[model samples]
Target: MIFTGKGFRFGDNVDTDQILPSQYLVLPSIKEMSKHAMEPLLKDFSDKFKSGDILVADHNFGCGSSREQAPAVLKELGVQVIIAKDFARIFFRNCINIGILLIELKEADDFQDGDVISIDTVKSIIINKNKTYTFTPLSNFLKNIISKGGLVNYFSAKK
Candidate 1:
C-alpha cells in the first residue's frame, strides 16, 4: 500500500469540525458535506483541491471530536492519505475505519503546499524531492483493512 500526491499543508490541532464543520454534518451524506471540507480553515478548499491530493499537518491533527463525519467527508473528497506529526487517537482510528491512510512523520514541517510527496508504506518512508523521512511501518492487519477500503469492505469480501 503506497500513496502519492501533491501535499496540502495544515497546522497543528486541526479538529474534526474544521475538516468538515458540524453544521455540514446535518447534511444528507458525506458526499454532500464533502463540498464544505476545510471550509472554516480555507474558504476555497473544496474549489481548489484535487482528487488524490495528500494532507500534511503538524502534531495532533484531528484534535477534537470523534465524529466520523470528518474522515468520511475527506474520503468523499478523494483524500487517499494524510501525513502528520501525530494524530488524535480516535481520529486516527476513524480515518482507517473509513479507508484513508494516516502516517506519522515528525518532520512534517519540511513539506509545503503543492510539494509532491510519495509514500511507500512497505518501506515506511515518505519521499519529497530528494528527501526521505522514515515512519513506523503499518501492521499487515492494518494494511489489509486499508487496502480493502475499510472494515466493512474487508469483511464483505470474505463472504
Candidate 2:
C-alpha cells in the first residue's frame, strides 16, 4: 500500500512505556490509551496528530517491553507508518502484526516534524521533499497481512 503523511520526528530509544506509559496501560482500550501516545515526549502529540500521519525516529525506536499496546496505541492515534533507523525486534513484529507499516532507513534525519512524506511501498521508496530513500519491501505474505489490517484479519478473510 502507498501512504502519504506528515512526519512526527522523535529521537532514539523511545521505549514502549514512553509510547504509552505503563500507567495508561490500565486504560480499557486502545482508543483510551492512544489519547496519551507520546505524552512523555510530546504532551499534545495525539491532539496535534492528524490521521495518516507518519512517525520518524532514530535507532531503537521501540526498545522497551513487548507491550503490544504500544503499536496499537500508535495505530489508534492515526499513525500510518513509522520510519526508523532500526527497531527493537519485538516492536518490529508487533507493528506488523497490528498492520502499521515500519520502514527501516538509516537516513531518517531528513524527515523533520511536519514535513510532508510519501511512501511508495510498491516501489520501496520514501520521498521527503526532493530526496528519496529506499528500503526493502516487505514480502508479499507480510504485505498481505498488513493490507488486510493485521494477522487476524488476514486469516479471517481466508476463511
Candidate 3:
C-alpha cells in the first residue's frame, strides 16, 4: 500500500500499554479496544486518524506485555500501515499474523513528521517526497496470508 499523507509521529519505546490502555481491556471486542489505542501518546488519537493514515514511530515499538489485542485494536481502527525502526518480536509477529501491514525501516530517521510517504509493498520500496528506498519484499507466503485476512483464513482456504 502506498501512503501519501502527513504522519502521526510517535517516539521510541511506545509500549503496548500506550497503544491499548489497561482500563479499556475490560471490554472484549476489538472495536471496543480501538477506543484506547495510542492513549498515552495523543490525547485525542482515537478521533485523529483518517482511514488511509499511517502511524510513524521510532524503534522498539510494542515492547510491553504480549497482548494480541494491541495490533488487533489498530487494525479495527483502520490504521492501514505502521512504519517503525524495530518492533518487539511478539508484537511484530502478531501484526503480520493478523494482517496489519507493518514495515520496518532500516533508517528510521529518513523521514520526519508531516513528510509525505508512499509505501509500495509489492516493490518493497518506501518513497518520501522525491526519494525512494527499497527493501526486501514480503515473501509470497506472507502475502498470501495477508491477502486471505490472516493465518486462520489462509489455513482454512488450504483445506
Q: Return the top candidate by lDDT.
A: 2
lDDT on C-alpha atoms for all candidate structures = 0.88, 0.90, 0.82
- Looking at candidate 1, what is the lDDT of residue 152? 92
Error of 2 at 55 (Å): 0.3
lDDT of 2 by residue, 32-142 (tens): 989999899999898999999899999999998999999998888888799999999999889888888988898998779989999998889999998988998778888
Flag regions of model 3 displaced more than 4 Å: none
lDDT of 2 at 30: 89
Q: For model 3, which pairs clash?
A: none
Clashes of each: 0, 0, 0
Give the runs in model 2 whose Cα sits over 4 Å from its true position.
157-159
Worst 10 contiguous positions by lDDT, candidate 2: 136-145
Which whole-number lDDT from 0 to 100 does residue 93 have in model 1? 84
Model 1, 10-94: lDDT tens digits are: 9999998899888887999778888899998989798778888899999899988989989887887788889999999999888
- Steric clash count of candidate 1: 0
Error of 1 at 115 (Å): 0.6
Between the candidate structures 2 and 3, which one is better when assessed by TM-score? 2
